[model samples]
Target: MNNLNKELHLTNRPVDMPTLEDFRIVEKSISELKENEVLVKTLYLSVDPYMRGRMSDAKSYIEPFQLNEKISGGAVGEVIESNSDNFKQGDIVAGMLGWSEYNVVNGHALNKINPELAPVTTSLGILGMPGLTAYFGLLDIGQPKEGETVVISGAAGAVGSIVGQIAKIKGAYVVGIAGSDDKTDYLMNELNFDKAINYKTTPNMKEALQEACPNGVDVYFENVGGEISDAVFTMLNKFARICVCGAISTYNLPSNEDIGPRIQRTLIKSSVLMKGFVVNDYAERWSEGIKQIAQWLNEGKLTYEETITEGFENIPDAFLGLFKGSNLGKQLVKIAEPTYAKL
Candidate 1:
């Protein structure tokens, strides 16, 4: 076994947008696993928009990444060694793990994945965080009834794409707002969204949203908050529901400058309900969400996409690309190929 490991550590707290310079690659010897621990060979690593919040020291639902310490997030790997009965060599697992080629993690924190049931990588994408986020946020928060209009910003993204599909499955008219022409095409042609607006090219966002949601939006999945969300707020129907999943547009801005038009009166007059949430809020119901999403996949009622960046060295690059709208769907990094398991 290769005892040497390379881990990515956060060296600096990013002021606005994170850059490669903020991270450092450190080479060290892998430590022996203790009792109830497993050494996993990372197969794939997920880079998400939510990780940006963890980069800052600001208090959030989750803790911030300690300076000069290993940055950890969602990872899928093959267990090369295990000290716990729950896991054994060659077992595929998914968990929050360090950004290293190999990680020694508590076996209990890892969930064993059956590779034969689905692609192992799906554990980090559609069948994982992104999929669960879409499922619960839409159904629980933004309940879309038949014939209702659902508008989603960042529509071509991992969570937003899934949200649009689930809304369609629930018999609602889905409208997506994306950044590029390719994304708009994907939302309209591939996902079958009723209408797709390319925010980058659209001169007037409110007018486009009004035209797309002719009957007014009954559900708004708020992914990219800012002008797009402002536009969505205008078209919200009476008693409309808004699932606040993310705010990527203002993630890099200073708090004071991130201010937008006050919508208190809009929510009052329209009786709109907007609630922000992190996926962990529904941890107790994750299995339920996963089962439903899996059923949808089996019935061909749902689909997903992934933009994978090859190589461990490029993980930081892949993460940074999220702000640039470089990925069409879930963005993941291919760390290394599994030696014992078939993928």
Candidate 2:
């Protein structure tokens, strides 16, 4: 194999919405693998809403991407060269690797993937961080009960979609809020959600939400913020629980001006519990969540959808699709097909 590697680097930060010009792809030569290091050939790369925060030089839970350096995120790849005892060539693995065709990483940083368990691409979607985010956020923070009404914002997204399904598994009536009628249909018909609301078309979100959640919202999995969340807040029942996850609705806004309607009074009046969390906060119990989700997946109790964009050059386009609501479920960029042979 040639020693050339292609990678995408953050060139500039956008004041509003991100544009393709903010990133530049460059080619470099791959280096020799050292002890405890493996050379990875990326197969599937993730383009998530969270990555948008890292694009700017802002104070955040994770460090911002350095200008002119390779941007890194979740990726599933095959080992092309290994100098580590723990991994051998051709082992499929998942880790935080650079947005590149090839990456040289420490073997300890990667989790070995069993191709037979599920599709390797799932390591970047339902069976990966997004799935775990839904599990812990809903079960731990939302704490839904049987016969309760659980409302999920950004319901057609990767995380919200799973949250609604898991709520159903727990015997709660699930209501999903998506951006389009097609996405709403997917939620109601395909995922078996109790109801689905197209926020884009609905003239009165509060009235629609009130109609859908006749029992009042007992658990709200908040993935999109702004006007959608304000409406959900108005529908909260006593002792309601809210899990504040990614706020894709406000990610593109200028940091200083990113504000919304006050909800402190709503929380105080209803005795609602609202908590925000990053998925890494549950790192210690990740395996447990993965085990349960995988079981549900195998038994057909859980299912997922993927909006995969082909070719490495379309990575930025796929990522931008997240903001425009161009994807139905999990949005992924298929860079290359996996080679299932050990060297």
Candidate 3:
């Protein structure tokens, strides 16, 4: 097989602070596949906040990305060569493939997707990890009940957007908080979130939450932690459920890791049940969650957004965009043409 030889690496060009060029892609040979391994070329690489956590050496749910080394994440790719019966050449698959244009990984790690059920990239977005995260996080953790009020921050992004809609599916009144009025409008007008609040434009977010909920937030699916969370925290009703998903607002902070809403006083008064989670905790039930979200989508009950960048080389920039709020739903870098998903 002819090797397509360029790969990206991290560059220190932005100085101590990491930036896109911090990684560079150089020519390399097509890796020799070991027994049970497959040489895969990435088709679409996902850019997510969890990748940002992996960039820093700080203690996190997983080991941080190694400095000046090739970084990897969830990606859709084509299997060019395979040594295992489970996979074959020309197979379109999704796995923990990385930033590179190509990679060689365990045959067990890759799951081949048939191209009729959905597009190939959907495996890296709504049909894959992010979809599962929103599904299980809201249903299993947040436990939204009918007629209850559910509020989500980062409500226009991948996870929060699904959380809000799933809450609506359960017959809950869903309110969303986003950074811009455009995002607010989409959440309300297009995504069908019961109400959308532009956090930056609102004079009093707590009042806005109060107005939206009317009865108070019964389930708070928090994604952006900081001032937005502080306001939502103030409106929590008795026995409220809180799922702490992602904290994009403070992700770029230079220091100060201690996190709690400024309105801690409200927690004591409301007796809210709060739990922070990394989505992988539900990886065991991943199939069930994904099927449910997909069924909702197929039935037109769930809608998703994807801010896609076209090319493999733009992975770093795509990941950076998450912190800047440049994406509408799931942010991804497309590396190849679509493979029709069958199931």
Candidate 4:
């Protein structure tokens, strides 16, 4: 066991796109565990689109990351030392931990992972925030029904992929819009999406969407805003429900320059319903979402993919990759190997 811990800190904020120089990796000595705290060795760290919003000073659903501070997000770790009765050494847990090799966190802040049920890494992806985000945003807000046409932007992404699959399970004809032809093929061939559009290659997204969704879009799972969303808005049927989960296309742009087509007229004319949400809004129902998603996974109704990057030193690169469309699914950095396996 090592006595030092390495952490990645945000040194500078980017004006346009994030670069590797914006983050600095530093080494520190691990401290002794407190009475109610446990010492955790990080295994997997999740890099998500929402974290990009936190990199800036702009006010939003969450607080911005402070300069020269340890960056934190979803992480799955193993408890190496415990001072709390709720947790024991060798217990696998997941929580909002730092971009570090080890973290000393309060036991209450971490949830123990049942390795017998699923791989511990999943606690950072499908069985965690991403899964919950898809569940509430799609089922609660979009509300796709039988024979409805569902459209998902950023459909190759973590949350969007799950949203499309859930829409299919509800008997909807799912249409996915992705950045690459390979992603579109994966959506149709692997995920069983009814149709898919490669936004980058399609000259006229509106016309392509019109041809694919003959009946118009009943539910729109908005992940990437801007032109893709503008095209989707034009094809919305009466009483269409739009779940505004994310707008990744504009996350890196300066706030003043982050503009897109206004949908007010479209909403009014079609009587469409649009609502933006964060996963924390459904915090109380997290277990419910987990149970359902887990059941689906066990029954082979749900499938997920992860793009794993090895080593903690590459955390910044993994995060920056999110905007470049470098990953096909959930992007994660593997920090360390699990010391104990309960399963």
Q: Residues 251-276, candidate 4: write the lDDT tens digits.
A: 88887897777779999999999999
lDDT of each: 0.93, 0.92, 0.81, 0.91
RMSD of 4: 1.1
TM-score of 4: 0.98
Backbone clash count, each prediction separately: 0, 0, 18, 0
The 10-residue segment with the lowest total lDDT in model 2: 334-343
lDDT per residue for candidate 3 within 136-255, as digits (tens), equals 888888898899999988999988888888888999999999888889989989978888888888899878888888888899898888878887777788889899888778776644
Candidate 1 residue-wise lDDT, 88-195, digit = tens: 899999999999999999888999999999998899989999999999999999989999999999899999999999999999999999999999999999999999
lDDT for residue 4 in candidate 4, whole number 0-100 = 85
Off by over 4 Å in 2: 340-343
- Comparing 2 with 3 on TM-score, the higher-scoring candidate is 2
Clashing pairs in 4: none
Residue 281 of candidate 3: its Cα lDDT?
94
Q: Give a tens-digit lDDT track for model 2, residues 191-276.
A: 99999999999999989988998899999999988889988999899999999998898899987776777889999999999999
lDDT of 2 at 101: 97
Find the candidate with the highest TM-score and give its number: 1
Total residue pair clashes for candidate 1: 0
